[model samples]
Target chain A: MSTRFRPTTLTGHELELREQVRRFVAEEFPAGEYLPGLGINAEASPEFSRKLARQGWLGMVVPAEYGGPGRTAVERFVVVEELLVAGAPISAHWVGDRQTAPALLKFGSEEQKRRFLPAIIGGEAWFCLGMSEPGSGSDLASVRTSAVRTDGGWVLNGQKIWTSGAHYADFVVTLCRTAPLDGVKHAGLSQLIVDLRSPGIEVRPIMMLNGFHHFNEVFFTDVFVPDEMVLGAVGDGWHQVTSELAYERSGPDRFLTSFPLLRIFLALRARRAVGAEAEHRIGRLVARYWVLRQMSLSVARSLDAGEVPAVEAALVKDMGTTFEQQVVDVVRELADAEQRPGGDLFDRLLAEATITTPTFTLRGGTNEVLRQVAAKSLLRGAGRAA
Target chain B: MSEEIELLEQTLDALFARHCGPAERTAAAQGLLPERLWARLVETGLTDLGAPDSGAGLPELVAVAMAVGRAAAPVPLAEASGLASWLLGATGLDPADGLLGCATTHPDDDLRLVGGEPAAPVVRGVLTRVPWGAAAGHVVALARSDRGPVVVLLPAATQVERGANLADEPRDTLRYADVTAVAAAPAPVDAAAVLRRGALLRAAATAGAAGRVLELALAYAGAREQFGRPIATFQAVQHHLVVMAEEVAAVDLAVRVAALAGPDTEALAVAAAKVAAGTAAAEVTRRGHQVFGAIGATIEHPLHHYSKRLWSWQDEFGTDRQWSGVIGRAAVGAGADALWPTVSAPLDPAPEAALR
Candidate 1:
């Protein structure tokens, strides 16, 4: 294998995409227009979501065959990372554009692809994942959401908690236990695309610590789905869900969530003369962040190559999240020592980041689960089958 | 660019495991390990590793330093053989196999060249707590002067007396006190750069030790049952273990990148890597001890051996606070623009640097 890496820096195409995305964010949903409040749906709004669609930035990852740019994962990473770092009001279309679109393009039937992919690319459609029920959070194998065979499709009857954007999502990709495969608890599950407007389905918003309705407890009461809505073959839900997770976990989003605050921290730190000690602290932080970004991008390249780098993704997420929290901690300490403005943008950004950071280790997968996964992969070579 | 160095890493790993086990390390601490083992290391071409045309070079030096650190070998392999050999090589001196030490700070002038005392002295005053001093055949001291930092070689046999460094290592305090020594030919090597390299290699050793501690803690966590199941299954201990793993991963990456950084950026990388690895070492060792409960602190337990080494090595080349201050000064002086241009610079290399 060649030791030469694809340049450690971004190239022209990537830079162009970033600048375009940055301009779209600035012009369409400037911070003044929709500065996220400390609530559940801090940055989610329909108008803001559609604005992205109209500008053709939403389908940056969607293939041209699906009315999208059909760009490389690197390009997608470049754009979304910039948007996320800018703290754009992007929650409304984030999942749909980021992972769901890619997953559908990979696993969706041609018809399913034709139906949802274009809308997703056009930014007119939105999505949420129905993988985690209350009892089965990161332990997705234990999902009890059942889907019984019906005349048209499958009748889904189970509940999914922490379904982000379900309140506004047009469709949800639901994972259900279709048949009782006896060998392992994971083999029996299957994925079905569910329409949010279908009868017997309930979407009740759950107020998070941030006090936003960004996520909802989506209940399925014998919810009917057309036969065409079944994603892939029966008993493939585990495989599909794992694929989705690899996408969700590996991107720049894992590390760049605190980027807005990073900018603010840099600006504020520069205003005062940082002594040797503080400079060292900040430099070390930046160095760590840079290395983590490189590692995360390596994983992204792996994903683009169609490899399931589950363990690598887990490692990145674990390291990236903790480092982000560390950055928050360091910045807070620096802020206190410097006695900088408490009400300034930097302070607000820091506070906002702090509130969101707890989820860093908990969200995608808890740190404990991630470590177990990491050890098994390194020691036992887990995920070899997939 | 350096495949030989990469291969040398495998060789050092094999050597360390063969010669520096717990018992051998303990024996070395007591000066009871067979003299032949050290002789064999020298005979195996490990001692002359940092010497140019000695078959092993910069890469081998790095690998050996890390390997010895990992083994927690009580020998001053890094200082005696690694740093001393490096400083000697820099001055175009033949660094023979045996004990050697290097000091960045030394006081003395106009004392030594050939016989009793020549026009200029090599090293003066004394460098206290010089690692590997007790056993080194020679100690190389670099004194900052108006010209630059002049490299001076002080043989352990003639001028230096030994002082205990406390741990089992061969550290010693030396008294140069107007001692006479040869000027030794000046070779083109930056003392600061060599020191930074040594610091980075030291951090690598600390990282290896920290990784072992984490592995031990993880294994213990797996089997040491608490209320019902193994404590590894417990969220609290598991979380801490994961945190340790994260630190290990971070330091591991930092060290590797710093190792590969170019001359211009090497110092910065070394400073950053030291801060990370040093901080990780202190924290991970403490947590590893915590997981072992009271047993880890007892002298009977081998865990202390690794932890003590970690504590000592973190303060050897550079402390966490010291490195942090270095980084902080650079960041502040560079301002926000150059502070982290690799990350913050508009995704494009600054055009001016491109022209070059």
Candidate 2:
């Protein structure tokens, strides 16, 4: 708010990385041919993830020493945006590469990093977040999930809901209360890397309204999480988790979910002599995408500079998600185009988006909750006194 | 940035802050000029930011223009001389063409440039809603001629249809059957650039005004108690403040980034800035009013000053519909495949020399 971005251009490496991703995407996912999924909820293809890994595109921020390509956040931004708008099937590594890799890099033990970072970037491993539970949604610190010390490990007993892809995930980075409460609600919290194949665990499908099974209810009863599986120090889960909120909130994914929808909408209307109304519609969406992407990239650049612009990131998520969701609203009205899809490409995607756009806000911290966070930060910045 | 640029920003901010308070706002609602404000600004010699080697650049000019907009200062045109300076530079006209009121967006049908006594070129026609032209020493208008688009600098000594925008800001309509242009440049001049620059400045000003409104909403929400606590404690009210801040941030970045990316201001950046600014202004003003409630609906409050200007300025240069058509058509022409590339085209690499 106080200063503008350092007026500058992308590095040659960043530009080159962008081109590489474009070329890789062109060959793998031909435009207008394949069924482009909505942003991250697209296809879960390990084969495609491995193919991306071959191009040195997966776990892009992972250091080469960890058997991963160490790239800057801006470079990752360049690559992710192209793939997202293309609607590449990246669900296999979406959470792992976006949230997990950085989490491991920051708080994972060396042994854990060595064990998982290689497989993560190599597209051989998958993970799911166990943050949300039926009892605890936005008030995450109020989680009732408990991990009691037992023998050489901790016995976890909790039910995590809306756990996307846990049935297929190899592991779940579960957050559990590790110690008895000590007044502070955030205290006694810890993150445990729980193996999904452990006994006494049940993954129940929580189908989306569209009858899709991207979500699930995972019940862990006395599931053992070894001491080594702990991410960061005990009682430090609050700090670690909150530290990553900025990353999760302010990414191309936040704004580009409905980007593919906009692309398809424009493609259908572009060649036609679309009336001024249609053109105006296209213009509004494109202009929004341009600026929102700019805002998202600014967050990425700040991250690369080792700055945690949490407020800016919240601004991005609140604004970015709202913008992307509106694209769905805009495109929903255009389902009956003078020219649409191969039979019903635009129709199918619009249908998928109409059902899924609700999650665009709810999934990554509800926009209502986000607005409170942003408002408080802004008020503080304004030095508002009551 | 250099220390001087920092100083310039502070100086201009303080200059506007000192005068554009309740008193000036009250006088403005009565349709009075902010004479003291304008007089002080002119005395600072920062009015003509386009002056060659003025030790300031587009960044400084933009900052000042944004301050002007934020203050809702009831001043005339030349507060930010970017478009004027742009015309002077584009047409190779003398820098001596003082206080130019740009009249580009208006229809140039009746306006034509013709050979007169060789001392002064003949310009005839109408220029409507030219931002505060009555205050400018000269009016630079885009005119049509046999060669192509001509930009003529006419002295603003003639009578105009003195107009007032919703905010009571001056918007004079220049009507001339045959006016002598002290300076004229033809064909090679850029009319589109003039319009885009106007759009860019309007966008910048709107952004600033919206920013001020957001501040107002935040302050009010934090102070006004409702249901035994500050209204800011309410989730619903917080939602409004957050959305307003989001829109303000987006537009603030849009215009600042666009202007700082200079030279290409004629291209997509300016258009994008206008669209983003216009769109965000809609959201900001609506949410701001909602937060202010009945008090905001009244004219005595200062909220209307910013909101009215935002409404009027957004309609100027080109509107969301008009500019969106321009952009949407361009995107269409470029094809869907080229859409992302065009939208994501990067800023120029800023070398140290360009860091002012």
Best by TM-score: 2
Tens-digit lDDT track of model 2 for A256-363 = 988887777667644442778767887888788777777888778778878888888898888888888898877666555533323566667777887888888888
Per-residue lDDT of model 2, residues B249-331, tens digit only: 77777776776664633367778789988877898889999999999989788899899999988878888678888888887
Evaluate model 2: give its TM-score: 0.94
When superposed on Cα atoms, how far off is each prediction in RMSD?
A: 5.5, 2.7
Candidate 1 chain A weakest lDDT stretch, 10 residues: A1-10
lDDT values of the candidates?
Answer: 0.67, 0.78
Candidate 1, position A266, lDDT: 67
Error of 2 at B153 (Å): 2.1
Candidate 1 shows a clash count of 16
lDDT of 1: 0.67
Q: Count the backbone clashes (under 3 Å) in each candidate.
A: 16, 0
